[model samples]
Target: MKNQVSTIYKQAERFAEITKTAIITGNISRAKKCLALAEQLLITGSNETKIAISNVYLFSVSSFMELRHCSISNLFPKSLKAEYIKQINTSGV
Candidate 1:
């Protein structure tokens, strides 16, 4: 359990870095990677730590959206936003 928690944090940190780079580069691919990694970690991580994981995921998504707004000429996918919101709500984040 402790190892799982550590792995989750490490994975989240990597995803956060990827997301930040995506924000700077305006690269959807990088953002996708971030989202993928974050989701994978959350799914594999312990239920006991889900609240914290969900909070971090929410923050990353919001950060990505803010950057998207600043750099992109068009909005990001609505479904992606919806998914994150759904996850957060379902997870009680």
Candidate 2:
């Protein structure tokens, strides 16, 4: 169990590194992938630390907000509106 947790931690760290690189290089696609992986790992994490989850949620909300504002109004479907609503609820903003 310890080993598994360690592996997950390492994987999360790798994802964090990738996220950092993506941010530095302005590579949105890689950043999105890294952020998604980071969210998954954090979801399974038993660690008490919550910074990872918070970071993921904030980043994801920011990304989606940009998408909503930048793209055509028709691009975001009504079905996905609930997802964004949930996000806004979780973010408390």
Candidate 3:
């Protein structure tokens, strides 16, 4: 179980990086696809993994917010935004 979670977490990280690159390259569709995949993987993760991934997402959101002057909620779907908020609150992050 532990190894599986770790593997899933790593794959999600890779997808997140891909999403970042896609966004940097102005590939909005690709970025959205990768982001969705990353979110799906995150949903299946353990609570600890969810918290870790939330941190990553928070960092990405902050970077994008700084660059684009956009709201954090605009970066995620409604469900994902809620989940991330829950993780952040539960983790005290």
The C-alpha stretches of model 2 lying farther than 4 A from their native spots are: 1-11, 45-93
Estimate the overall C-alpha local distance difference test score of candidate 3.
Answer: 0.62
lDDT of all predictions: 0.57, 0.49, 0.62
Judging by TM-score, tell me the better candidate of 2 and 3.
3
Tens digits of per-residue lDDT for model 1 on 1-93? 654535555665555666777767868786766656555546675774454456665466565666556532233344445556676587686
Worst 10 residues of 1 by lDDT: 71-80
TM-score ranking of the models? 3, 1, 2
Worst 10 residues of 3 by lDDT: 3-12
Tell me which residue pairs clash in candidate 2.
none
| Candidate 2 residue-wise lDDT at 29 | 73
Candidate with top lDDT is 3
| Error in Å for residue 86 of model 2 | 16
Among these predicted structures, which one has the highest TM-score?
Answer: 3
Greater lDDT among 1 and 3 belongs to 3
In model 1, which regions exceed 4 Å deviation? 1-14, 67-83, 86-93
* Per-residue accuracy of model 3 over 1-93 as CA lDDT, tens digit each: 654535544654555666777777877788667657557646886886666566665455445645776455655765567766776678686
